[model samples]
Target: MSLSRTAMLLALVLSGAQAGQTVVAIRGEDFLINGKPTLEGRTWRKHDVEGLLPNSRMVQGIFDDLNPETARQWAYPDTGTWDAERNTREFVAAMKAWREHGLLAFTLNLQGGSPQGYSKNQPWHNSAFDESGVLREAYLVRLKAILDEADRLGMAVILGYFYFGQDEHLKDEAAVIHATDAATDWIVKRGYRHVLVEINNECDVRYDHAILKPERVHELIDRVKRRSAEAGVPLLASTSYGGGSLPGPKVVKAADFLLLHGNGVKGPEAIRSMVERTRKMEGYRGQPIVFNEDDHFDFEMENNHFTAATAAGASWGYFDFRMKDEGFAEGFQSVPVDWSISSERKKGFFRLLAEMSGEGK
Candidate 1:
């Protein structure tokens, strides 16, 4: 076959692969892309990530609105009706812009949790799964659009399957399992390469459902892995802890990768200590470590969250929640996300990421 035809055929084969399939692999301590080392010469405890250090964010509310009560919802005015074309276009544009600035991954939640407490009457139950345990078609379409765009932009997505607050919307643990199976099967069928699975966001949070609680969280992680295996997809899976707490030994052993949060950590030394401490655990085997959610905003400080994480040889993610201020843009976390790099926090993060990843040049 001609080179063009050969490339086209290879693409078709890849596009048809199962979800959770081995799109990204761990090769001796480095993450491998198409059998080649990525994030060259950088390794945490002698193991390097296959691709770029994922400069990720918890952008759960980007595609959907946060407040269901208001007529003019956060993301778009028409909350009930899904605008496939406009939604995809804006999401793709945002992903492209972030990628150009060296952001390689994002942490998106299927069921987003509210940072504000439940008593505040927050609409924290916005979820992709309905009560009947079916993944919403509209949500799936939006997810596919983002994943497709991420693949095209050479970026990855850390897709969170459940959130504690909204998980109650499901009837029971079996329904949760059914939802998991269905979602994973769909992902497998779609054959997305640049995606990772986070079984639950902050598993330590107080979940109404017993199955999703902290003590039994590893079971769900295992369940996701089993679903992937059964579907012939190689899914990398992990669950996160709440702010200031390290994952227990069970989670550490169960997860394919270690995810740590630095929200309440005081300084860079504390961050370094956490990473070092995790490495010293008994079952620890030098899996790739990432600080996937940290809300510390000491951007100009010397020992800020970003500097602390990178210095300790771990990948980092930014988590900033912002309420709508009259003069400010909504790119930062919280509701009504601008989706553009409008806030100083977003700009500074991308700038620093570009500089660190050598994409700035």
Candidate 2:
């Protein structure tokens, strides 16, 4: 029996080496499984870059490409606003469906906020907690529910706790820490074990969004890492961004793994340019890297980007929100989802991606 066990173990080790797979796979980006580094051939998916942007109307307006000046002219559905329960059910179903296609949804926060304009997503308050405390409370309650379901489904939810671009979602030092701690606790309890803890979606501040002092980002990363550890989940700290706070130490210095939001930068070449710059950097060289957001609109685009990111020694994923049946790549304006299919675009993109990366197969 001992001989058998030894031989079996030796065979396993030999096969792993023969196949070119590393010994310990990256839980997220520690050591990717697919002969890739950081987050090779993996796409950090998020359908709506502005999922937590603001309100339905504004979201629709943008989808319609309505100019801010004429934003009011564009009327959203009479069935306005995303209700928590309904959104949860819908998201849960969407993720299940996406699994069939090999794709997964981001966290509910990607869609977190309110009609007053999703928590902190409101333009008027950018980062102020309401004196009434209504929005924030409602948000946490709903968010808690969403995380619960995601865990049940074993879905990978990327919690964007920092200031992406929704200035309204901005938090002062105290609030930021409080919120981060809260989110970590909630996710842990629910068992959603986040695939990644992405701080500040895609923060792009205009004025030296650069804080000479970057203690806050570092602090946020450490707290979440600790909280996630307590929950028994292998936590990976990352920041998703493209501009504004470009080169901010928040990303340059503070994350466990590195991520880039090359939203409009399609094709392998464009992505390569950015990947090269980062991999060659001082802090980025050895750490893992991922492309959490590349909304080029469909599986084909995801394939293009994932291939590029991986070749560059990074992992990547395409974004997918809405009911899986809604359609792929945000569903062009004219071909909007009927909201009934519940899993249309889910099939192609994820399946193709998983297959290409050798996961689906």
Candidate 3:
């Protein structure tokens, strides 16, 4: 095996030594899988994650795009029934490319909300739950495929369980809880150590269902942890906020690691301030903090976010979406994602990541 792969396997083995089950653990601002520090011996701090890329809403259209009508037609296509063969192929390909370019983490949503306000026929509403409340078999198959590929590639997946706008489709709060239990149970049964659970994409966002509103989101996080404990799987769990907001004290205390967003953050200074303010929150326990979603543009400004985040000893994530006039040229966050290392933005981000993390030398 290659050195990176060997190191990853060793880490998994070490972390799973206790219960003989692969798991991810939080240890003082670092993420450990099978007891070995992730991105170890890199330029950044011992447990800091440096190569997060812009892959928000990946699960939304990944399968739907296979439909004949949508087949690469729209910017974000949605035209077909879920096809396991093609979905797995495309997902694995994108993931492999990401791993090759030093991206160790990406965000995926089970139910993707509309970036533009919700519409009657939003193509990206391909949620994992069906109208009857059971987990969609097709979604589970694709999810497992992605998780399995992530485990093999030594990468981690920040799996968001729900998204705004589309979450109301579920039958009720009982359905939501059942879905959570089912998802967590499946992960534990499969022994995946590279998955982190985000109960909702942005807990503070408007939701038709009261169960998932910001006030009670902490309960979902707790449920995830409890279910993992029941299954004997050590999983990392947290929820994210909308841009320019910090999680509430209940959320701060519930999450194993803190997840922040940069949607409306003004610049690097704002990013730094948010990180600092979060660290000083009433219930803050000094867990690893990460900006898993941000849409700020420009190389200098983007660099400012990265620099500020790393300087504050926090991790950062890139958020890009496809706009009408601008093709995918900017670094990190552009839309109609090629998923390959095709854009200058992707190349620049990976190159900077290599320098920052001391990987791909």
Alpha-carbon RMSD to native, per candidate: 6.9, 13.6, 7.2
The digit string of per-residue lDDT tens for model 3 on 39-94 reads 66555533345322223335432333323454333343343233334434555666
Give candidate 3 regions above 4 Å deviation.
Answer: 1-22, 44-88, 113-124, 300-303, 327-337
Which lDDT value does model 1 have at 212?
Answer: 74
Candidate 2: tens digits of C-alpha lDDT, residues 1-361: 1434423422321212121111112443344322333223333342211111100111111121112443342233445432223433333344444444333334223322222221333332222123221235434443444444444443445566544334333334454555566656655564443345765655443212232124345666777778778777546666555521234454666677666765668467888788777766655546656566555445555447655665565556554344344323342121122222234453455555555433444
Model 2: C-alpha RMSD to truth? Answer: 13.6
TM-score of each: 0.83, 0.60, 0.81
Better of 1 and 2 by lDDT: 1
Off by over 4 Å in 1: 1-22, 42-52, 61-88, 115-121, 323-328
TM-score of 2: 0.60
Lowest lDDT 10-residue stretch of candidate 2? 50-59
lDDT of each: 0.67, 0.43, 0.66
Which should have the higher TM-score, number 1 or number 2?
Answer: 1
Between candidates 2 and 3, name the one with more favorable TM-score: 3
Clashes of each: 10, 30, 7
Instruction: Judge candidate 3 against the unseen true structure and give its global Cα lDDT, from 0 to 1.
Output: 0.66
